[model samples]
Target: MIRALALTLTLAPAGMAGAFELGFPVDCTLGETCFIQNYFDHDTGPGMQDFTCGPLTYDGHDGTDIRLPTTAWMEAGVAIHPVAPGRVKGLRDGMPDIAKDDPAAPALNGRDCGNGVVIDHGGGWETQYCHMKFGTVTVKAGDQVGRKTVLGKIGLSGNTVFPHLHLAVRKNGVEVDPFTPDAPTTCSAAPDPTTDLWEDPIPYDSFGFLDAGITDAAPDYAAVKAGLPPRLEFAPDTPALVIWAFFFGAKAGDVLTLRLKGPEETVVDQAVTIDRTQAQAMQFTGRKLRGSWPLGDYVGTLILTRDGVALEQRTLSATVK
Candidate 1:
């Protein structure tokens, strides 16, 4: 059986007005085709083999890829501005462009997420803008930026088949469907531009007024608990056993330590650094084990800490045959 555990942590006030907003990185022009690609959409079709459309892998495609055609012959170096005010968390430059056929390359010079910037919008939310032109990153990691601030210029770099920006939002370190559709899925050959389009910046509507009213609400513990789907149910008649555990609500800079204990507290002491400023959801599965120990109680604990302060912790128990 597989279960989902989510723990949310908010580092801002209970309610801060307009803490975060979504805006188009570039002005919508005739040739500029800006659309949001659903995480699921990226999974189906010919997009499967391309890892850029899949879930975040060890290779570092951390956020969703926002594709837009270039309106003009954009210079190799241009400036990308911040859609909203936030602190710059990560930046990389001096890389080269990636080949059109290879999606695995880094963002710069055959790299993925080429010369990019990640901005922390506070309140456990973050946004990543990838595929900037090389040497255009004007801000360094950890710099504070305001709305409309130029961070870099658009470019054809990284795992990009064309000139486009990959943008994504993470809440409490977990990526959600920012482009939630108002209607159900309609199977078709051509991509539906209406429902398929990325939702306009949540911060400003067409009129430039705050839409969602930037919020710094405390961690929604209840929502986090409710968001997690029920654990996978298993039967004793099952032939082979395979179990997975998915966890959400971890932020970058947090130290994640996992321990599996059966009779006593035996620690595995695996340490991982959450580099993505956005919330992260990870699934850990137990590979096939030929033999099974005596059916008993087992405990799995996930501890998250940052700067010596314990942020979140979760424990789960299971019985084996």
Candidate 2:
């Protein structure tokens, strides 16, 4: 479902130089408000690898995916900007923002990019911004624009199940990885940034937490994907106490530990090992209330570890009233 639109675009030329310094395409800060959900696939065969030789991408992925934490953030609005100055080449708008799997979703019919914008940077260089919100496109075809121009807002249009900007770059009409113009023929050394496109360095993260919270019951995966509402106070008669986390860049064998500490004592301490790699994942652990939870505060901690070393830890607190 991803990048199916990009694969159909006609190529420019093969050997043109892709020398250009690009800026961050999304408005939010990386690793905090937004994250790189996918990178350009580097492997040539029927396999997948990112610039870092990591599993952050899928086979045939042609762009870097910058994703907001949830649909709620999409509703609040997050803008998408061009990486460089150019004339708006072409654009499409008015696509409904619906999940790919939703029963009412429209047929792709090569409209997979869904309400996106294309900018011509000259010299056979151009960029595409896809999956943008309906009615938020501020620029029109043939309009002059720059990095500061707000093209549109991130959305769940096209073949996406989540809100994100699927950004693809081309030189001479041929797809190229902005992080590294030439995809690695072999996954070996780390990516060399000197020849990359970004004006400032975007750190390569292997894994991190997207969101975490304390809830009164086991989290609903679909609701979590939509975005969990913040709640810090719970009734004493709550059915259970749960701590849940949403994360990305997971690898097989990674160990996740979820611990909940009540006012006077430690309540639940649980560890789970990931058996498969996932682009985004959710996990949770908690205890059901017997009569009523102790009237005090509870802290839930989530620690994700790899190779026996802790990689990231997030804590959420809740109070019983």
Candidate 3:
């Protein structure tokens, strides 16, 4: 069951986070690409539900949020485009894209969507692009746009944390899930939508593995977000080594396993089972060693599985002097 309320948390996937890996609405760069920060909330009432009854969504969230990993990318400028051909119907721009903790963010009022663009595809198909960077919108209120037309750059405008494009789709003005185009979420009794816009929407077993790294210490967001990450190399005098892996979704009874192998064939293995369904990441810190250590290459491998089936696996490596 969804909690009575959604307390503000870090970024999250709104839906199942699936894709055909083709024809993205934004210029997708490796490590700089966007993930589904939120999927549309299919539960239009008291209980919460995504199309699959998954935890990847919140109550009332009505769009597929493609989110950037950091604010730096927002400033660097990422392009936003339309998935299908359409013409501009409405738009707004110029609101500052600030952090959720910023004091000036709350003043946006109904303009919280910040700089945005709207395109109306023919035949009951209309799309809304929200959180565009200021001064970057290339189209006007009544301009025509192609499937690949550059609408604007992604930004932190609107009610958002990281940089992203909240692509809200509608049919005749009522909200709809872009992922499941054929089946209306309101008809919960129907099967999952078979029609999809993506050419290949199947996600890999470990698709949720967003980022992984080895650190000199138990990592924090600041350290993880550091421009020069703590992985790849470490000094000989380093006190302790910590390994972390970030993933998207997990439910009770799912198992997460981690293993570390040293140059001399030393191995460290640890495992944890999720206690509930939620969006989160996990960390594992190796024992702090004092003596000068014999180190060359160290590897950390993570696998997430349930019911004897592997859902995902990831590996990280670091070197010491």
Task: Report the C-alpha displacement of residue 114, candidate 2, in angstroms.
Answer: 0.7
Better of 1 and 3 by TM-score: 3
Of 2 and 3, the candidate ranking higher by lDDT:
2
- Per-candidate Cα lDDT values, in order, are 0.46, 0.86, 0.66
Off by over 4 Å in 2: 1-18
Per-prediction tally of clashes? 30, 3, 9
Q: What is the lDDT of candidate 1?
A: 0.46
Q: How far out, in Å, is residue 93 in model 1? A: 0.5
Please name the candidate that would achieve the greatest lDDT relative to the true structure: 2
lDDT of 1 by residue, 9-32 (tens): 112123222335455565443122
Give the deviation of candidate 2 from the true structure as CA RMSD: 2.8
Q: Which structure is stronger by lDDT: 1 or 2?
A: 2
lDDT of 2 by residue, 39-143 (tens): 888776678888888899898888899999999999999999999999999999999999989999999788889989999998778999999998899999999
